[model samples]
Target: MEDGGQAQRAWASNPPTAFIFLITVFAFFLPILIYFPPFPPFRRDALLETHVQVGIQHPSESGLRKSTQKHNAGRSVPVTAEGTARNNAKDGVEETPKTSTDGGRIRSLWIYPIKSCRGIELRQSRVLPTGLEFDRLYMFAQLRSPFPAPSSPSADGSGPVEHTWHFITQRQFPLLATVQVDLFVPKGEADSDKAASGAFLLVRFPWKERGLRGVLESAAAKLSRGWRAQPEKEFVLPVAFPVGSSSSRSPSPVPPGSGQESDAEEGEDVEIEDRRPRGYTHEKVTIWRDTVSALNMEAELPRELRLYLGVSNRLGLFRVDPARLREVRRCAPTPAEAGYQPVAGFQDAYPLHLLNLKSVRDFDAKIDKDKDLQELDPRRFRANIIVDNNDYSSPYDEETWKKIRFTSEPGNRKESNGSNDKKLVPSTFHVSCRTVRCKMPNVDQDSGYRHPVQPDKALRKFREVDEGAKRMGCLGMQVTPLFTNPGLPEGRKSWVEVGMSVEVLERGHHVYILQ
Candidate 1:
């Protein structure tokens, strides 16, 4: 009995040798298992989740469509046929059973010069085959980690990551919304020498730790809550766009009878010095699955701005390399449904994003039950074109639209003898696919803070309509300009302007392609 008691004490004091060895081994490999999981990690669709890596690898076809229904309590209506809509009337929501054909007008136009940053609203914007001019022409990338640690932590602090010039978006950093961008072109003809030399981009953002006076003013402004504070810092960057063409420096034929000094100087070329920084470093950066070769701006950014973004590493601003164009092919089930293969710059997927205003209002109505949540802001969606859909009875009627045409009706202005004015050329856009949304819209565009449960939670209730991305909810539709000769010098005639009539040219079912 004494020997047994002694054995029990010895066992308690020194566990089993095998057990001790196993624990020691576990402690040594714990980090490795976490960093590199032995089993497949819980990964959402490539574009559906925030990717830690610079570029997300394309998963297998079978894996792409896997159901990732996070909130499955709400009734889901499968979009099997054209004009398939949910009957929310039973749920105390009034819904129209029929679709409207008269169409809606373009309410607003927006251009995001920098990807995922504050966008500029335009009254009229020239439309290129790729997208609206000056839309997503540049992007801010993280060059290094702020932490002294070898690898910087992921944006969500998922794990240690090494991101060298990886694309940064609101999904990763909501504060990016605070960065404001403006294009400044000299007040003259687009081809004029002065216009080219003086064009620049104005960028502004808030900085940390203002001086004593600035701090006191900020505190006073906060306490008052009656006025808004301006950005703490601002910087100007040279604009170089239209791919290879130098800004306004290239010689263009002067307009006829411009009141210049002499007619002989009309064709004379002016030598405007190139103001862009020299020795631009080229590197490959990834936006979704495509890896694009981009030019790293040589201009040094303020350290305060980098620190404001929660990074110690220098923030690298990149422009799309002119030599390498990223072709945007349609992500559809069949070739017939796949539209023209246009090119893009720093945009996430397609060239243009169109949203129906009624749809947004309906989304707001859906979340009205939650008293804690406020009305969802349309800016959170970041759509390039917002159309007024008061004419349509049903929200999300765009889900059935396959193509849209834009036309401007001539007013009563007529030629001599009362002949009707020539009809304006109509521009058509192919509806590529339904926009698959992530939690990106959850970020407040104004405050730059993500809402805990939001339109994202409400979206899952009724917006999950795409069969391809069955798990993700869809809100807007991706569109591509249908131009016969997009590459010709004079082919760019389509202009999307506010108040233009938007008519549904075709209607059909849509299936999402995760390319």
Candidate 2:
């Protein structure tokens, strides 16, 4: 009995025995512990109970109270000039002696001469009432099926048949991005005729593999010399479309001198008038809801160009007629006060789309982390003005800017009153609406290849916003340039350039939060 008691005591006190016992127990339960942890699973109920107990003990103190106290503590502290300067330094908000130190500069300028085609970058460009000069001046279009009959009836009482045209864009043809434009502004002696005769537009398909580059290059070379050099291949198709013509055909010319008898019979002098052949074809065309007579360039387009596009498409060139200025629709800060209604060349809505460089960077960062996509390109957005803000801490800050002012010279710092301030007047553009993105951005601007999942998917995840009936992913702000210099000649246009100082005239009342 003594020996048994001694053995039991020795077993209890032995470290090696206890260690082996623990190891055996752990080995036995290892798989079970992994399958079902020994500790209770985390529960919201337990957490809430603990929180309630903590709160009861500290009833007088809460997160809200703590925040309020922190806010009030800052206000209560008396700040000296030196202390304020130190605080400002700590906060990183600079105090500018001038009106504003947040002077954003235009980093790049782009003009899309042909709708949905490749954009042209420029250091300086003239700003037309419609948009930047030559922006969206032309669009590719095709004849709509089941064409509408002409408004007028034929002499035999039969309805006049007419071919109707509608606008086509990158949404249908991604290859449009391959088309490039070269605009030549005549210099020296021809400078005064800039608007009339000196300016010429040459379009070319730069795709070398398709053998279109040579054809386009030849056409461009001929157009540069003179339109008359290639009379049969006139680069500039002269269009004499009637304002509201119902039929595609040109009106019958009045029988020669039918209005008045020969003045020679009335003992009056008869003057002979020189007649020139009408060099343009007029057609009834519709863009969106606005139907206007336009000149179709079916005959003017080169055969190789049409073949390269791989479709029976005609290019429609329409100039913004001063007589019929289209008012900006569905936008705030209406353009009615601008004396003349704001116009656009062929833009779907607002003339200018502005994008911030920081926004693009932010979007690219998200894509890199979340998606298996190639790095995004800013060219996909095709904004007219890209504002660079190196000091801006947040992306999409431009969404809060309701109005922006552009100045030629950066030194005079004056706060803009939005209108009628001569000191602040330069050129102002009002943010009309958030630009709703489409699948067009999915098509690579350089390669014309479509990504399986990209921009659209990522934007849906991060940048989706409620716009009308649909939720759209947006990246840029659509804007309209206010007519600051209304006193200038009717035909004279304004200008904006790269490297110009851009100031936020006013901030939006509401910040657009992304979903």
Candidate 3:
């Protein structure tokens, strides 16, 4: 009987041990259970429907969708006479009624013709589908790799890889900021004439030596002189060519064994007078992950620029190909569904970048606590639109503005209750996403001198935010302009000028807090 009792006690203890063992097993697989839960299949459509119900429209179906469809369908929505008059208003004056005091006025406008270069402040500017007229139209690109022949297959089995080009920004080349760019579009010239003349993009480095400037000025003068001599044809000055290739009209060459070749001889000074119909020569180029076509301005560029920019591998002035519009990626609908994609010239992301003055002042306060630092220049952000936010209490309030509608002048207002009416449609922009800032802001806009500890450090401390897989600092909002004047004929003047009132049409649900 004692043995039986002992066996029963041992069995009872064994049950406890078994229970402990099971607990250990459960603990081991807990992570798996939590991570790979046996939940119902996720239905994107249902989630989207839920989002719609909550007043969160799909990014693709924002204000731009309907207008784009209408534009694609060849329907001309007439612009009100008032709207036209407001658009034609003189710079620095508000055409809107003084009674309309609820909205913010456009404080300033800026356009950067070259990516990563200094921006030009304007009192008034034209807005295009891509962005502000001439904004990021040109970008300096370096040859990433040589064009592989068809016989030479890439290791990745992607077939022959042609020459790859990538944009060089201040992040990589801070010196680019030192290069001043001035795009001269002759006033009163017709669009066709302007295209034919090809806006003279004058780039100069005033800080550099006089010799470099002289060389550049001389080359530009020569090109301009040639163009003026024969306005119909396109002139290209060849800076460099493949070795051993002979030009039909070559400059004086060095004698054999001279061991020294003149600049002309080394580069093969060849002038191409292309009589063929004047049109941009388009070539495929890569910017970030997007491979799109760009207009190659290499042939038209002066030799001096090649030398200044270091064209050992290859240097080219590339313009965003208007024919091959680069659709805004991330938080926007696909080009096919959108009917017409919101295009950008050579912007890192969206068409327009907006920054509130209050946010900048707040940032300045944080960095320049002692007021020692030269008042932090808002130009560092390189925003296309700068809005005065003195009325708002908090900084970065613009981030929460999901959609903004720019009111036309008092004269342009039509008595209409429908918001969708063509006559009443204000210049609207859908805030696409918060701009992900990089180290480019560390460089001084005026001098291109990079500071070791600055905006970057301060940003990392205050403005850092996790963007999915990566952490980036946020400063401005990327915006896509919704078509307000669909009836305005193509190439006709339509723009948002300074002093236009901006009203918040929609607000974002979540308040983005920088960690």
lDDT of 1: 0.62
Q: Candidate 3, residues 476-508: lDDT per residue as tens digits? A: 888877663434436322456555577766555
Q: What C-alpha lDDT do the candidate models reach, one value each?
A: 0.62, 0.56, 0.57
> By TM-score, highest first, what's the ranking?
1, 2, 3
| lDDT for each residue of candidate 2 in 1-515, tens digit (9 for 90 to 100) | 99999998998899899899999999998667555644333222222322211001232432223323443465332224632333223112233323332446676677776788777676555666677766776666777544344345643457554456887777677777777564443333111323323244455563222266545534443444343322122133212222233232332221221232243453343332223233346556677677765555455466655556656755444443434445665663554555455666678777888887657766776873334355677888888887764353245666656667777553433221122233233567777667778788787886677676678888877787434415667788888877655546553355565556777676543223322
Model 1: per-residue lDDT, tens digit, 1-515?
99999987887788687588889999998767545544322212211221111111222211111211211234242223333343121122222322233456676678888898888776556677668767887888876443556443765677866555678888878888888776655433332324433345567787535587567545443433334753255555555542233332333222112222232453464432232223556777777788788877636366667777775556787877545778877652232333344767887788889987767766777884454457676778888888765432366877766678876655412211123122255677877788988888888876688777687887887888777787788899898777645556467446666666777776666778788
Candidate 1 vs candidate 3: the TM-score winner is 1
Error of 3 at 311 (Å): 6.5
Show the colliding residue pairs in model 3: none
Q: Estimate each model's TM-score.
A: 0.66, 0.60, 0.59
As for model 1, its CA RMSD to the true structure in angstroms is 21.6
